[model samples]
Target: MTTPTPVVFIHGLWLHATSWEPWIDLFQKEGYDASAPGWPGDPDTVEEARANPESIADHGIDAVVDHYASIIKDLPVAPILIGHSFGGMIAQKLLGQNLAAAAVAIDAAQIKGVLPLPLSALRATLPVFKNPANKHRAVSLTAEQFRYAFGNALSAEESDALYERWTIPAPGKPLFEAAAANFNPHSPAKVDTANELRGPLLLMTGGKDHTVPEAVTRATLKQYRHSEAVTDILDFPDRGHSLTIDGRWREVADTALDWLRRQEL
Candidate 1:
């Protein structure tokens, strides 16, 4: 029997591993081992996270990346890493360690070399960094806030339900890190995977994404221009930063799966 490749999914901020249930299911059905690792002390459900936002306050990029690194160390084989938003940043970090067979970063946050910050991305993150006290706290978004940041292109009912099911308080420190990434010379979020020859890397962008705009995605592509292995980029014109959770998530998932199949992994 042929061995299956394992896939580790890292969710974006304000979301737990459970948020990737649909993607996980699709991956499993395709004969792959898939796991979604939660941030430290993440509550099991959205309701629980909403009720006790403080539990996620201590999770920063370093801690979260280290948690996944440990998981990869114990895996039977190096797995494909897939992440979105903050999770996308984590995926880039993992790829730099040469720990994965492949990786896909969807609307990932800014790292060291990529410097374009659209107004929409700034506005989406303003709630977390607006207050000094928020540095060590978890901040949840109101419905209106969620609508603008995550559901701008979806229907009202879909937007409302997504907010109810997936929105939660996220750690503030990662936002701070992303905000200051360009200024930090030694930041791990800065990935140098251009020399990695073992696996292909894919960077995807949501064309309508205010959180991580197409311009930023193009910048990321340029940074990886020196990669020895093939580097590719995909743009979903109708999707937003919440493409993984919004109405068209399946389409995005299928796109990634298609890429994986082409690699025959």
Candidate 2:
């Protein structure tokens, strides 16, 4: 029997790793070995993460990339990477490093070379930037703030429900690192985008996403222009940043699965 391909799902800030549970189950049903591992210092559950926010603070982009790298080393295969938001950024870094079979980055955060900073993107992250001290702390989002950042394309009722179920305090360091990526020559937000031999990558963007705007994703695509590797972009013009966790999440997951199949991974 052929060995099933493994898949790793990475979540972005303010979301517990368990938010990928549905995706894991769906991928397993489709014959993939799927798992969603938390970031460094992340508790196993949302309740625990909420109660111990301090444990989730102070981690930065490089730490997160290393955390996932350790997990990948133990897998039977390099695995396919599917990440959302900041998770998406991590996926690109791993893929660019040739650490995965392929990667699907959904509404990924801005990498080093990405330049457009839409007003909505800044507004969504204002809570962290407003206080410089947040860089060393974990920050939680209010329901209204969550609505603006993640669920603007969703109904107030559904958005609030998602907030209650999956939200958790997130470290602010990665945001600061990405914000200063261009200025910092050693920015951890850097990705190898020029690896011609790296695995294929598909970047997905939501037109209504406030947090990681569509323009940012488009620019992220351009970063790979120097490489001859396969890099593709898909636009969900009607979805928001919550596309991976919201009610229509199946649509996004199915799209990713189809892409993976096309790659014969």
Candidate 3:
């Protein structure tokens, strides 16, 4: 029997790849090889990551994308890509380059063509943007900020628990890089939406997400309407940026799993 295609889960800022463990386990149980790789220099655990936030601080979107692309290149078969937040943006980039068989981007960071820069989005990024020096530093969020950006849909207790387990510092460069990508001639935030080989792309949005809200994800979908590939959007009405790690994470995973099964992958 042929081996199932590998599934790669990319993580966003302020969280390491381990946050995908539940999803990885679910996918593995479904007979797919799954992995969630860290950005270069990521620590082994959240505690270690918090202690050594600077380890992955300097790597930008280009660096992180190249890291995952290299991993996919070494796999035995073309992989399905699933990413959250910045990982979502990275997933789209890989798909555009013909690297993935399919992709699911959840609450993804803005790309070049996305136009709604909501005020909530700006507040969510204040930890990094409030300090110009953060461009070269790793930025960590306070519990309040995390609640606002990621756990807005969860109760206070639930949000606190998640913060203790999954939250960490993130490199500021990628956010800065992607924010200016539309105008930067040398920006690494570009994607070739016209690629016929981009396969199927799905952008998942959260109704309660402050960081990458529905408007942002919808705009991303509109950009891909020009692509020859099949592009779609799925919105979780009661979710937030923490959709993948929250109590109803299984619901999100089930939706993605069902979508993949429909694609016969």
Q: Which candidate is the best by TM-score?
A: 2
* lDDT at position 235, candidate 1: 90
How would you encode candidate 1's per-residue C-alpha lDDT over 1-265 as one tens digit per residue? 7677899999988666788999999999999999888888688888888888888895778888888999999988899999998888888888877889988999988777888888998898888878978879999888878877878878878888988888889999888877787788877567875765647888999888877899998998888877767788999988887899987899999999999999887
lDDT at residue 34 of model 3 (Cα atoms): 94
- Candidates by lDDT, descending order: 2, 3, 1
Ranking the candidates on TM-score from highest down gives: 2, 3, 1
Provide TM-scores for the models: 0.96, 0.99, 0.98
TM value for model 2: 0.99
**Taking the tens digit of each residue's C-alpha lDDT, what string does model 3 give over 1-265?**
9887899999999987899999999999999999998888899899999998779788899898899999999999889999999999999999988899999999999888677899999999998998888998999998899999999999989998999899989999998998898888777888777787677988899999999989999988888876777887889999999999999999999999888877777
Residue pairs clashing, model 3: none
Best by lDDT: 2
Model 1: CA > 4 A from native = none
Candidate 2 vs 3: which has more TM-score: 2
Per-residue error (Å), model 3, residue 56? 1.4
lDDT to native, each model: 0.85, 0.96, 0.90
Q: For candidate 2, list the clashing residue pairs, or say none.
A: none
Q: For candidate 1, which ten residues in a row score worst on lDDT?
A: 189-198
